[model samples]
Target: MLQKKLMLLGGLRYLLPVIEEAHNLGVYVITADYLPNNFAHRYSDEYCNVSIIDKDAVLAKARELKIDGILAHAVDPGVVSAAYVAEKMGLPFQCSYEAACILQDKSLFREFLTEHGFNTPKAKGYENIEDALNDVDYFNWPVIVKPVDSAGSKGVTKVEDKSKLREAIETAISSSYSRHFIIEDFLDKVGAQSSADIFTVDGKLVYATYSDQLFDPDAANPYTPAIEIWPSSMEQKFQDDLTAQLQRLFDLLHVKSGIYNVESRVCSNGKAYIMEVSPRGGGNRIAELQDMATGQNLIQNEIKKALGMPLDNITAPEYKGVWCNYILHSNKQGTLASLEFDQEFQSKYIRDVGLIVKNGDQIVPFTGANSSLGTLFLRFDTREELDSTLNRISDYIHINLR
Candidate 1:
């Protein structure tokens, strides 16, 4: 039997599980990116030097690698490239290359949603800061400005006044690789936003789950979510409706087998809207958390889909507990900080914690997913326990910084 070959675009840490699993299954995994020191490369069978964002270059490299399949899970910059390579090489793809292009670009996505009559925010894309500033007066207050192609909330901001539009636009443009940005109506969060991970097999959704995405008002970036609680608080009817809408969207776009990380909301307007639909796994190990809660390995299914292996794990999710993943970060820059929890805290509720930072390590202010300190997984027996614990988190959790 030949060792199956797999190519992973972009060497992000989140790709580690895919590489390890492939290795365990006796598959030869090749990791690719311009950076030689990206941590994921340390675990791959081979490392290839190539820019993941350049689709043509990546396709050429993939063909040269003679790999069986390709994936860009948890790496937004590599999604289009992965799709392009797979489409060109007659391998499996998450969606059509054209659909990938529409999904990857914020401007294009918003336009498509509106044109297709989806529940969407009023948004406009701009390449000219001056033009955006001139048109800023047209939008309502508290509009969100963000880079069109960037993810992890790198350059997302909410502006309350016209005075801040130029600054926000500059920040977004600086953070964007393509120097394009979008300004959109900011829907008032009614309860909590929803960010979820769902799986599809053979152009059909197989499993779906969402979480109530919570934010910290005092974080360096107020828009960045501080935590996520699984089994969303949204009414079951809305969840079902959102699932139908998402399935419709995929069907219309002809999305194929893989995982989708979606950001959406059931807002103050009493309408559910999808803010983003990226055909890849999410940051913060959302799929991993789902696996932990449901005893199903979406990572395996995602890898199998991309690599043309038999789909064995696709099934309706059977949840076990109410879980949450804390997006740990500091509101200020610091060094030599201590994260301590009460003695009873761990025994009572804390399931697992991975503090990515160490004592005396320089910590950046909470800005986006890139600045996340680590992930803390917690499980509770009931919704009340989960809510109470999260509501008074500072009581049991301490962050002492110098």
Candidate 2:
């Protein structure tokens, strides 16, 4: 029998890899979340109906079970709770509790970065409409408003007109569980944005990698990531500089060991900027893709740390080829009937496709990350081939929303 028990926060299917890894390591796996039918529960040894965002409740459950470690992968709301329980229990922790709280709160994170001399955008946070309205003119013309602590790009609004300020603030607050929001100047990204992961062991950075975050400007929310490509098309020199800056940030935060989701970009000002850095595996199996491209097993390492085991070699990522992950979305709200792709897509471009929704399942209008109904992965032989295909992907495939 596996004696060590690992408690995972949230049973989203994204954690299936972590669950499988733990099972293989002979570690008892348990899942917790408000949803009982999260599918991943079927693979867990036991399940608990606790709200992942409620730290005290989850910590109580963890104590009752006497779990050896706690992890919240790819779920933003669960990160703070998992870190809190680990800190209180004296178990292996990703970072100090104080640092984890700052990383989880968008406003605090931005403040920390700005104070530390990192390349970031001017930003402000507010909890109410009046306060945001009063400070609206403080920024440039075009701006972005979003929930301070929300994930999956929910409640993010692009406001180019002052008349839309109140509406944008309301939308962001509605999406935020904390009822807090942040407003920042909309940066003109030099290339595509970057959404990737960095791993550190004992306050020493071991792995740092990034990808080009592609988006569907025609989608309900233009800011939501549509596709992300590994081996970013960014100039190699820019990537190198960003990597160095992140290592310094990791050390400043005293991050000992954990997987972090980082978003950055080269802006129109001809400088690379670090937009966001959160301590958790990102949504959409981003780290999983990196694991596939490189030989590192980040999923296994995350679980291993919670169990107080030595981490796997995260030395450096070795890209075998160019790869991309696409989020399948629908432009209309209706039942999903089918996703049809041209013969060329099936025969030449797409490596694999996965539909999170079943035939006849409800498909919501493409809005944020949550609206994605499926995933598409691609492997291209050359950078030029990858760029040309992404630029004209929609012409080759279509999702039918009945």
Candidate 3:
């Protein structure tokens, strides 16, 4: 019984539920990048002419497609070449390649979470902006300068003083591909770090999910995290203290099988600051709204944890429901002429409605999360009918720009 040959790298729009849960568990998906109309390459089955930071042309096309599984769930420039083809085909990845180069080098993941203190958020790593203006008095007024590597929040900024901190560290070190730049110390905190997104196989945590933060009050200055909502509102003793600090950080970075995706934050005085850790998964449409709110396929459990199997025999579907995603930002730089959502104001909690760019497709002003143009995938069954179907679909959508 061996028909699992998966290899997915980059494709915007959260790799469409890892290519529809690895083609509904039969697993033989393939999706390399260089954007050929990327929306998970229209539900991948195969397509690789590579280029997502081509790590040896994606390990020579995953060893000329022997591919028994090696993934890069939702883009981070293809998670270090899908952990270097699961470290040259040994497989079962989620760390190693030196913890995927300390989680894709956000200044070595904030110095490995500030040397294990873990509640980190007073950061500062820079390949010069005069070492962030000599630690800019250790940090104070509205600070955050991101791009120690880059992600959806491409370049991320927010600097309340010193005349905008040298153009926000030269636009976060010129959009760092690794030129480095990170400047934190601005956890004014409301909530934007509920990406637990776990799933380990040999190392056990068997599937888990939680992602929240879908805000946009005019894209809230230097704050980032514009949209994403899932099974979290952030309080269950702060997700059991972020599941005991991410199970002691994947047991001190061993990370057993595939998919890790941790990001953390919770400080209205509760204090829980992980801030980043991405093996992969959760970009937009968060694993397709976590498999439409917990059916738990996660791309055939990341192809049965890259074929080692044993995720306690996969049944998962208790179904409470409350998935949400909404991002329509444009503050100027426009084109898209229409995008209206209401659908009789509530087609039983609408499951999807994407407006993925068209009508000229220019719009790019809302900075972070790569200026998401449209999305809204609510599902309901509780959280007060998903907040009354997101306030009656925000009084029926009307997102026109021009």
Candidate 4:
């Protein structure tokens, strides 16, 4: 029998686990992206140099390689391209190419949600700044400006004054590949935002989990998620409602078996809203952390689904203990920095530390997810201990610069 050939878009470090799982399954893994120096390429059976954002280019390469399946996984920019390639090749994919395009673009996604009667923020998408300025009155005060086609909060800004709208628009346009931006009413969350990876089989929701998504106030981009804790603080009633709504949305989209990264929040208006739902794994190791907390291997199941293999039984996760993933980052630019952790804290809570940079490496302010230094996985026996430690995180962990 021929070994199954799997092509993965984007060579980010997050793809390493996928590569490992593919290898274990006796599949030939090919990592493709424009960058040849990406770390995941080192582990893949082959590396293809092609722009993942260019669907035609990726399709041509996948045809040349004769791959059996393709996946974008944690990389957001390549989700549309991967879907296009998979559809062109008649391979297994989570959703259709049209569905992927709609989910990947913020403006299209918002319109779909509103049209489907789901609770969504009032938003407008614009290709130029003048039009958005003219329609400023359409939104409520304290709106969020963001790129329509970017992720990891790279081009997100909270604007209360209209005078700063142009600057924000420029930032959003610069970050967007399509040079488009969206202005939306910012829903003031009643508690920490919820983000998680959910799974569905043949358009039926099987597994769902939620986390408390936290942000660092001192970071350059305060919207970027700085930490995530499992077993969300949201009321059980809201969680249940969101899950039902999400399943309905998936059925409307005709989604197939696969994993999705979902973002949601309970607003101060005494309502719940689904903010974003992308058909790919979330960045910041969300699936990996979920695996540790629930003993469910979403990564492995995702791979199996991509390859058209039968998936293992995937059920709702029941977390054993409180878990948190702290995205390590700095607030200022510097060089030759050494990370410090309190000995007692490290011994008690820190389960693993995955550092991306060594001492003497240049580091910059935490403007986006790309600027993160590393991630720390922690487990606690009680929510009180988790809250107390995270509230005073600065006292336990420090990033010293030379």
Candidate 5:
């Protein structure tokens, strides 16, 4: 066994790659989270029962274990806390606690970009309906309102009228931790946009993959991602330009190591507006999808970067493939009596069936992808195969609710 011990602060869903790579590398992995049944904990050698938000407790535990390096790859909430432990222990961490805070919080990030002269959408942050309404004149209608810290499209609302502004602000603030919500001028979704996931070693770019989002405009609520497909169908130049912009941002931010997910949009005129940056890999099934489209093992590279080890060269695979994650959701809130997936589908490219909501569990009223029943991850050898499978899966699967 390796002498180095590594500590991870997120659950299995986020730490799947970290745990797998660390254990494979012969390092002792310690998984910590609030939930006892978290996915990653099941695969780890040792599990710690603690809340991800409890920074002091986590730091104390790290001291006891003498962890060589700490990481929070896909977990945004724990990134700052992870850096806290690294800073206190004088370990080599990628980003500072202040930088992590700015990246994790949308309001702070917007301000940072504005001050830094990075391309940004006009925006404002509010704590309540009154504050939001007081600044209503500052924003154009159809503004984007969302929780400053929430991810995966939770508590995102697009306000089109003055009457609905207060309600949107209330909903956004309710879902946030700091009672803060960001209201930004909605950008035109013309042309193309993609979420670029990149890895850097010693502040230099190593690997990258771009995923195109299938935006659902008329899905009642506007804050859902709906579906995301890898190696976006966009033109090659668009991808290269966006990558260049991200390279600049990475340099400016002084990203030493680990993964970074930058959500950017290519305007109709070809300008790329950076949406946000996370000092970690993307959530949902992005990492898994990237692996399918490209032969590169991102999870392995991320671990090597965090441990200060040299990573193998990462390149896009020769074959073209598509990986899609469909968010299953319902219009109403009720008891989730039962859930089932087609057996044939499971045996095929369908990787696994995961249900965040279980039988007899009460489902809440949700407007977007945040309240999904579960995620359906599909991989295919070709785009044609991917499209055909998506159509078939759409018709065959069922999410029975009561």
Candidate 6:
């Protein structure tokens, strides 16, 4: 039998598990991106140096390679390109190229939600600063300004004062590849927002889970999720409503089978809003953490779906215990000194520690997902212990720097 070939669009460390899964299934893996030294490239069977965001370039390479399947997985920028290539080559994908474009671009997504009568924040997308500045009155006060096509909360600013709107727009445009930005009314959340990966099969919502998306107020970017706790504290009624809404959305978009990183919140206005739903696995190892908490391997199932292989029966993940994925990051830019952990806390709570940097390596403030140091997988016997420990997380874990 001929070996199946799979071309992955990005070489970030998040794709490592995807490559591992494909290899376990006896599939040949090709990692492609502009950077050759990316961590995942070291593990892939082949390396192809092509810019992933450029759909035409990726399509050319995929055609030349005659790959059997392709996927972007946790990489946000490459999702549209992957869909485009899959559509052009008549391969399997989560959605059409047009659907991917709408889902990936914040502006387009907001428009879609509003047009479809989803409970979305009032938002507008702009390609120029002058246009955004002129329409400040369109949004309610305390609006959020962000890049229309960027992910991991890069260049997101909360503008309480109208005077700071221009600076916020500049920051957003700087982070955007298309030089576009979005200004949306901030939905004051009732509690910690929910962000997790959910799966659909043939446009039917099959499996869903939500996490408490926690953030560090002191971090350089407070919008970037610092910790994620499984089995969200959100009320069951709200979760069910969100699930139904998501299924409706999938049906409307004709979404195919795959995993989607969904962000939702129950607002102070007594309504639930789906903030973002991108057709790819979320960064920060969200799917991996889900696997640990629920005993479901979404990573492997996603790989199977990508290759057009039969998928394992995916269902709602049942949490075995309270779990948290602590994102390791520094609040300041400096040289790494050492990581300090309280011995008793480490022995009891810490399940696994994955560090990307070593002592003496240079470190930066946590501005976005790209600046994260690593992740600490933790498990607690009860919700009370998890809440208490996380509230005083600094007492147990410290990232010392020079």
Writing each residue's lDDT as its tens digit, candidate 1 over 1-402 gives 777789988877788878877777678999999999998999999999999999999888888879898988889999999988889999998898999999999999999999999999889999998889888767777899999999888999889878988999999998898999999998986788898789988788889777899988988898888899888898887788888889989998998888999998888878888889998898887888888889988888787887798978678787788999998888877784688888887888888886667888888889899888788888899989988888888888877789
Q: How close is candidate 3 to the true structure, as a TM-score?
A: 0.31
lDDT agreement with native, every candidate: 0.87, 0.87, 0.72, 0.93, 0.74, 0.92
User: Candidate 2's residue-wise lDDT over 97-137, tens digit each?
Assistant: 78989988888888998999988788998877898899877
**Residue lDDT tens for model 4, 329-388:** 999899946899999999999888888888999999998989999899999999999999
- Model 3, 1-402: lDDT tens digits are 767788888776666656676677777888888768777777887888789777888988888888887777767877888787778778777777788878877778878878988887777677877767867788867788887777766777777887778887888778887677888777866666666466666555556556777555565343556566777788778777766777777788877776666777787767877788788765765665566667665656666776666654544234556667776666667687876666665476667776667777788677676676766676766778766655655477776777
User: Which lDDT tens digits does candidate 6 get at residues 196-219?
Assistant: 999999988889888899999999
Candidate 6 Cα errors over 4 Å, as ranges? none
Q: List pairs with backbone clashes in candidate 1.
A: 336-360
Global lDDT for candidate 5? 0.74
Looking at model 6, report the run of 10 residues with the lowest lDDT sum: 298-307
* TM-score of each predicted structure versus truth: 0.97, 0.96, 0.31, 0.99, 0.88, 0.99
**Model 1 segments beyond 4 Å from truth?**
none
Better of 5 and 6 by TM-score: 6
Worst 10 residues of 2 by lDDT: 346-355
Task: Pull out the clashing pairs in model 4.
Answer: none
For all candidates, the clash counts are 1, 0, 1, 0, 1, 0
| Superposed Cα deviation of residue 313, candidate 4 (Å) | 0.3
Q: Give me the candidate number with maximum lDDT.
A: 4
TM-score of 2: 0.96
Q: How good is model 5 by TM-score?
A: 0.88
Q: Write the per-residue lDDT of candidate 5 for residues 1-402, one digit (tens) a residue.
A: 447778888775657766877888888888888888878888888888877777898899889988887888777677777888888887767777777778888998899888888778889877767877888889867699999987767788777887898887888877887789999988876544676567766777666556677655545454567667776777777667766766776777776777777787766555667798888777765675676556777777777766667778765443255677666665557888776677777777776555577788887644654466767777767778876876676455766678
